[model samples]
Target: MSDQEASQTSGVIKKFLYVNRRAPHGSNYAQEGLEVALIGAAFEQDVAMAYIDDGVFQLKTDQDTSEIGTKNFSPTYRALGDYDVKKIYVERESLEKRGLTQDDLMPLVYEDEDDDWEEKPMINLVTAAELQDIIEQSDVVLNF
Candidate 1:
């Protein structure tokens, strides 16, 4: 069935969690996961994304794929807010282990429509335990 049909029939907004554990460029997992999340959001699902392990690097800024002969898809992340997929959780442990900080990541933000469209940060630095809780709360979990 189509997304609109499914939504009209069920009228249920499910919480979808897309978990990323792979590096962004080496394979297709990260990119595919991102595409799926955007599609889910477009379907009016409550979409959230989690970055863990090497996946945290996906959010890092200033990615240059020119030398590698790969298209730089990192900029697409900034568009998540437009899709209403604003809950982007970055695992603290993952960043620490890689000697990275939140500052190293892209500055993603969203406008709060209910609050006079106030711009707010979208990337949330979360503990492993907190991320687990979020995972538990999700209705569907997609792993990459």
Candidate 2:
């Protein structure tokens, strides 16, 4: 059997890439995407999440949804690390067009056992081309 086929039969982890392309709270897509990511992570798969276009706004800090009659779920992103879902990639171009920087995003960090349990940033800044490469390497890609 081929390497990938053999790996699948051996129950090796599969790489799952979730692409988020919508503005958070404008509709249900962003929230649904996050839900899907959480579900996939729960399966113990290798999950990688990419935020592109308006989806980059989902990580913006200090989001207040109370005025819109919605519960602010932005903080949930911070909890993703607890679920072991930490490979978050934000497209640099998308952030630039939105006039956002890494500082504008919520500080998502995880406890690193390899680093003596020190916390490290979960979000990764990536170029559009790099995101594309990631998509290509994934076993499955879910676009939102």
Candidate 3:
């Protein structure tokens, strides 16, 4: 078996790249998606969560989750650091037209500010080329 396959079976480390592409609380799946990410982290797997396209909504600032009366698990995202799985990245263009600046998302994530703003979520954004590299590097990928 390949090292990655062997590792996965041996329970050594399974590197997963989680692709989140929905708004938080917009649907029940988004919340459940976060749960899966955390569960993977707890298993001591190397997990990285990526917010692409509309998935950026999952990391919006000042998310007043009380109306839902559901636990705001967004805060728990920070706790992923404790699991040593803290590579959270949001798409640059995704942050722009949403009227969200980098600092606007600080508490939620460490996003980069030096990029295009006031653009469509898909315009002038990181090319799929970049994402391909990330996908190739990960042992497995889960989409939400």
Candidate 4:
């Protein structure tokens, strides 16, 4: 293999997990984090995103970006699929606290549930245990 092939190989990770624990549009943290996820996805990285606590706010409905005086990047969440990085998972308890159900979330908020709605329900929430599994399955982890 050439040096270029070796460099590309070195950049790949088995899995890359990012834990987003902040609200969208509060600062640039959430925005930058999502950028990282998208970049990883574009690079063909096995990227996964987890919403913990306030991170659920990122999936909130009908954002008022005009008042915030910034471009609304909220809709970009749905575009992750274009980059093949839609392995989105949320915490069950966080949903309950936010009074939000999977159905309540917007179209962008993707939960990795089976497509067969009849054969399997579409709740893609993971308990704290499963969150641990997410971490364990990841070869590289980022906390944002």
Query: Which candidate ranks first by lDDT, i.e. highest?
Result: 1
Please give the lDDT score for candidate 2: 0.87
lDDT, candidate 2, 28-101, per-residue tens: 88888888887555467788889999999999999988889976888889888887887999999999999999
What is residue 7's positional error in candidate 3, in angstroms? 11
Better of 1 and 4 by lDDT: 1
Q: Rank the candidates by TM-score, best first.
A: 1, 2, 4, 3
Model 2 steric clash pairs: none
The TM-score measured for candidate 2 stands at 0.89
Model 4 stretches astray by more than 4 angstroms: 1-7, 10-13, 109-123
Show how many residue pairs clash in every candidate, following the order shown.
0, 0, 0, 0
Q: Write the per-residue lDDT of candidate 3 for residues 1-144, one digit (tens) a residue.
A: 245654565657767988888887767777888878766654667788777777877766677888878767777665555545557767776777577765666353232234432211211234356666777899989889
Error of 1 at 76 (Å): 0.2
Query: Which residue pairs come into collision in candidate 3?
Result: none
> Candidate 3, TM-score vs. the true structure?
0.71
TM-score of structure candidate 4: 0.80
Query: Tens digits of per-residue lDDT for model 1 on 77-143?
Result: 9999988987899999999999999999999998889899888999999999999999999999989
C-alpha lDDT of all candidate models, in order: 0.91, 0.87, 0.66, 0.76
lDDT of 4 by residue, 78-113 (tens): 777666666778898888998888766666534343
